[model samples]
Target: MSNLRVAIIGCGSIAQNRHLLEYEENKYVDIVAVCDIVEERAMVTAEAFGAKSYTDYEELFSKEEVDAVSVCLPNYLHAPVSIAALEAGAHVLCEKPMATSREEADQMIETAERNGKKLMIAHNQRFVASHEKARKLIAAGELGKIYSFRTTFGHGGPEGWSADGENSWFFKKDQAFIGAMGDLGVHKADLLRHVLGEEFVDVAGFIENNAKSEITVDDNAVCILRSESGIVGTLTASWAYNAGEDNSTVIYGEKGMLRLEDDPSYSLIAQYTSGETVKYELGQIQSNDEGGQTNTGVIDHFVEAIVEDKKPLIDGEEGKRSLEVILAALESGETRKITQLAK
Candidate 1:
């Protein structure tokens, strides 16, 4: 098989830290083009990878033939850019939150289907080592009859991680759609669904901008989610963790309890009802902090899926399903009512 020629849209932190590096490391991938509104950023990335640089994605598409693209643009641009890439005959691996609204997400999926292209969402949490191990354990009935969980993803804020620091579009409602929820919450939503192998059926929560005065978008959000099998849990996404990042999940079950990404030493710890304790050092979860550039397994999976002509684990439909939980939580926060997800 020939190498998969790839383009990266939006040379932001995600593109720089994850997609670009991962693609470069993949033997099956060729980084053929890079695009960013900021010409300097595009040029820098393109030079580093020995690829073409473009200020406009449309122009890049017109000139460069790409087998796949990573849509690392802002939240609002996810759907449109992904649809455009798919229509241009390239598989798309878009960043999380998928889109600002369900309608946009649906359109992205429809466009991918129409063009016969793969549309994968970069919900990297699902690819975390601890998360993968937990999913398997639960699937094997190790955590029998799961009852509850509390998953959280929090950090100081996007200013430190975004390309433009404090001036990044993440602080704007129009560009980001939602702040912590969209940036961080959607990750946990997708992770929970994958680990539990269930859909979230209901959501209720509060989303507020209490932590950041300069931002119009919410900086903190806490959601109560109920899965289809009656399992319930809380999901918290925050940008107010000034001390350190907290990306952890604790699951309670009839047979044992599982703690994931909670300990610095052990990535996963399992405690059984009969006095058995097990710990697995499955490496660390990737984070915004320095020395957190662990291989995410997302780019490799996307490349493999395209090369093998198979559906990605987190395809467009899966991405939309996770987005629905975030959207429902947003509605619940605004309306002060429990939002029931569509069946």
Candidate 2:
């Protein structure tokens, strides 16, 4: 196909703000349909993108001639929609965390294998230039032997940022499964794994509901990870920080330390034991309807993956690994003990 026809499931904020707008800038993609249980949302998104709209994703899958699809539904629906789309013969780009449970993630992976379709997860942080550079430096042994790290992704909450905030499906356990850990924590977990090139062997964690009392799921979480390589680290994710701190990651090694934060001025900073520090002024790549939005690199990666017939850096299995870390954290939080990763 000269150009791939695409469909989007779940016409929610992510579809409208990130994926749809990013796709608009890609020359090799033609959005053919948009599906959401809320017909108005689907219609609005379809109209905005000049595509057909449907309330039933299955109808869109059966009727639309799409080569790929972006599944932006809630956590619980991610695996099912992705599996269905893959089985229907379309490449899938599902949002993280991969799935609510490992069983569902395995099923999604199995379906992709059976259908021979690409199944990528939207672990967008992996596409950032600073993140890419950091990974390269780590891989090149620029930092020498690694020690420990700290990472965080937090905000006032998903309320104003989401279509309905606390009332949005994000707060619903049946729909979202896990709260902050799945929504934001998964990013750090995956990022740590990506940069460190290590698998987490165990985790201990805690969760709190200091905000968004309307939700039954966790609003804040903290976890410690012990990697198979013997490196250790901490990850924190919260939706209750009204002070509005964006995501940040810090890494320490025998020779130096690296920091990546959402500050508009300097997004990347590095300090060495030799009393030298480097700062990079990496700027935004896209505009958000509101503040603190990151970049469009992820959308470009998705398009490139389809055009080049290459697997995405954050494919389904990679995403599942991230989710496994967060799930281990949740289990640790509940049991108040270190949870071993089942591998």
Candidate 3:
């Protein structure tokens, strides 16, 4: 198939590191346009990728013959931009914590369904090799009778990640809607759901902004999640881990325990009840320092799905379900009660 002509809205850190860089590596994709509210940001990114630059996404949509688009905007703009792209006859791969609200997420999914276009959420954690192996093992029932698990994704803060640094839209309640949970926690929530192949039916979250008190959004969140089968676990997302980042998960089951991203030398370690320990060296997790080779498997999958006329792995419905779990946790934190999610 010919290269999928693509446009990217919002030239933020994620757009630059994940979307733009990945598209550059994918031979099936051609970066047709880049958009950002900041003129210079758009111009620089466009020049680097040899694409047109636009300050307004609407203008890009109207003038470009795009086959797909990546909606990498701030949390608040995810829904409308994705809906518009799908309406404009473009498949959309939107950055995650899909939208600020379920209502907006529902609208995006509906628009894609109506337009017969693909809508995939860029939840890259699921594509991690170690995570993928763990998922396959769990699905094969190697760790039978899954009992509990704890997942965490923490770092210094978004101040180091976003293009705008401390003044980025990530710190704004109106723009981000939520903070650590939306940023780091949602990734774990989605990862857990994908690995366990179970939905979180209940959630209780303790949300706070202790690390960055100046911000309106939470900088630390400790969440308790319960799966449909009664398995329980804790998920913590924080910006206060001053020493370094911790993106790890430990799963306990009847036959064995599995640890992912918990060791610097090994990506996964499984301890079986038979006293056998297995180590999996799946390479380092993708980060800004890792450069462009940190392939997330996102762009490839999205491109293949569009070309092969198949649904994306993390399609709109799947993303919305993971999003619902995070939203439920936020609600639980606000109401100081265990929140129930739809079955």
Quote the lDDT for 158 in model 2.
71
lDDT of 1 by residue, 170-232 (tens): 999889989999999999999999999999899998999999999999999999999989999
Candidate 3, residue 199: lDDT: 92
Name the regions of candidate 3 deviating beyond 4 angstroms. 289-293
Q: Measured by C-alpha RMSD in angstroms, how accurate is candidate 3?
A: 1.0
User: What global local distance difference test value does model 2 have?
Assistant: 0.85
**What's the ranking of the predictions by TM-score, best on top?**
1, 3, 2
RMSD of every prediction = 0.8, 1.7, 1.0
Which pairs of residues have clashing backbones in candidate 3?
Answer: none
The TM-scores, one per candidate, come to 0.99, 0.96, 0.98
Error of 2 at 124 (Å): 0.6
Steric collisions counted per model: 0, 1, 0
Residues 248-309, candidate 3: write the lDDT tens digits: 99999999999999999999999999999999998878864454467789999999999999
